[model samples]
Target: MAEDQLMTYAVGEQMNLMALLKNVTVRVAKNGKQYLDLTFEDRSGEITGKFWDASEADVERYQAGRVVRLTGKRETYQGSPQVKIVSLRLANADEPHEPGDFMIHAPMKTAEMEEELNQVIFEITNQVWNRIVRSLIAKHRDEFFSFPAAKRNHHAFEGGLAYHTLSILKLAHSVTSQYPNLNAPLLYAGAILHDLGKVTELSGPVSTQYTAQGNLIGHISLVDGEIVAACQELKLDVNSEDVVLLRHMVLAHHGLLEYGSPVRPRLLEAEVLHQLDELDASIMMMTNALDKTTPGNFGERLFAMDGRSFYRPSEGLTGKVDPEK
Candidate 1:
């Protein structure tokens, strides 16, 4: 019920770790190990803890996602924090709680992001592209307005899908505007439609879990199919070859097939969309990781940002005067 206090085990502190640890991960041990690997987390961030005591009762209580209380000494494993657990118990039910009590979230404004997204859709001038975009928007506007761009990796937050999609379109529209050689409509249409299926492919308000269709059909096939259907229903003369071009943007959006794209990006528009998506996503993720940093110090090592950690400059956190005052 109480706010679980963070254990500030710095680089050299004697981690009196036998304190309550919450938000831990339970991983199945590889190749028949005796114990499970538990990853515990709090707003200060996460640590890996191994629980070897394996009592049947304890196993039931500490299943993956079930919050647990723990006592352990904090230790460093290759610079990241590790916990040596001495005692463990499940968090009691009927406690005052919030989902944020466990899951981490991106530093972003969902409402503001969605509002800017509408502006991008509004900017589409092509009648055909506008028709398709508007139809997709109408079907999943609520979810698209709230869905995550991914379950993890990049842009994985509430309203993240809209934010990431809008950002990609913004960059694509801005960059291609400089290159008169590029087909503005092709690039813009591709960018706007590239990730629309993601609105339907992911679920969860606190966690961006994949939908059943995400695993079975995948976003590429889903979006491509939808584009074809929309083109047919609208009686648009979307020539088969050009539809292939639009589909290529969806299929090759990841830049390569190994990353789940069915084809590699070959066209200039496809290549640009792929790169811009990566650019926008990677920059936003790094920015999100950087924001959690404490003043005048390095941040908790971010696995999502590679092995390297971030350092927050002291003045970055300086107090500002309230203009209204």
Candidate 2:
């Protein structure tokens, strides 16, 4: 019905792609001689096609993860959808990048999330974490307010990373309150402020993309450097045990070096922060992957994890949002 699409070949008798803005990239060759791996996503969902022949001129026209319109024939490879592209070019970025193009998720209500995060910010006893977080938020408020959580995968909406970071800290706040040995105030400060560097470490308005600093020093080290600098200005009792624990919370929040925490969680509060962060991200991602339904049992194949289709129930009332949420 749309001008962009005309009857071409089909994936099945009922399934086919009408020419639309599919994403493109220079991907590795898994089998035959390869040119570019063209990823096509439409209102229906995303699927990949092979441009077995690509010219140098075409390379100049396309970039990885860019949306593009492609004329192609559908074919199945490895029990999944694939395409053999006939022609292709970049699609308009002006078009929205919603779940139709790529999955974008915000796990909780924006206003509520911000308020809760600020609550933790107030609970912070460490002066250095307070000042640095304050400066970063003040200077980069626009970016923080508008940037997506990630370019793809996980929480990648404007305020997404902040939402996720704060949610974890909130959970940690309650859990750590039960431990008499843990300095709840210091731990709460660390949890709330740990990922503040990501405001600088990522870029973009609609989709959260990694900044050069993120690619190089990463959010952890960038945060550490910011904290270390902010500490110099505070002149807090540097020898206090709180200083040691606060630094550890930033450095070891990831829990292991392999996962990006330079140091493992050496204390109870840090360990709790690490698990809460991981769990929040995983749940947010999993929930988004399953939200939109396509058909019986299987909703659709998810691009974030290479076509792991989430199960969509055939019969039930669509779930209601949490009132407090």
Model 2, 1-325: lDDT tens per residue? 2333222234533333333333456654656444776655443434566766566677666654455556666665653456666666555566542333443335565677667767777766656656656665665665555555566556666567667667777677677667667767766777656777777788763324577988998878887776666667666554567666777888898888887888998988788777877788767665655553333645445565455766755676678888997
lDDT of 1 by residue, 100-213 (tens): 565444455667766665677666666777677778777777777667688655766556677777788778777877987987777777887788888667665343557899
- In candidate 1, which residue pairs get closer than 3 Å at backbone N, Cα or C atoms, i.e. clash? 17-72, 18-71, 18-72, 19-71
Q: Which model scores highest in lDDT?
A: 1
RMSD values, in order shown: 6.5, 7.1
Identify the runs in model 2 with alpha carbons over 4 angstroms from their true place. 1-24, 28-33, 38-49, 64-67, 70-87, 91-113, 125-128, 173-182, 203-211, 237-240, 292-314, 317-325
- Please report, as a residue range, the 10-residue window in candidate 1 with the lowest summed lDDT: 16-25
State how far residue 297 of model 1 sits from its true place (Å): 10
Q: Clash number for model 2?
A: 5
How much lDDT does candidate 2 score? 0.62
Question: Please, what is the TM-score per model?
Answer: 0.72, 0.69
Would you give me the overall lDDT of model 1?
Answer: 0.67
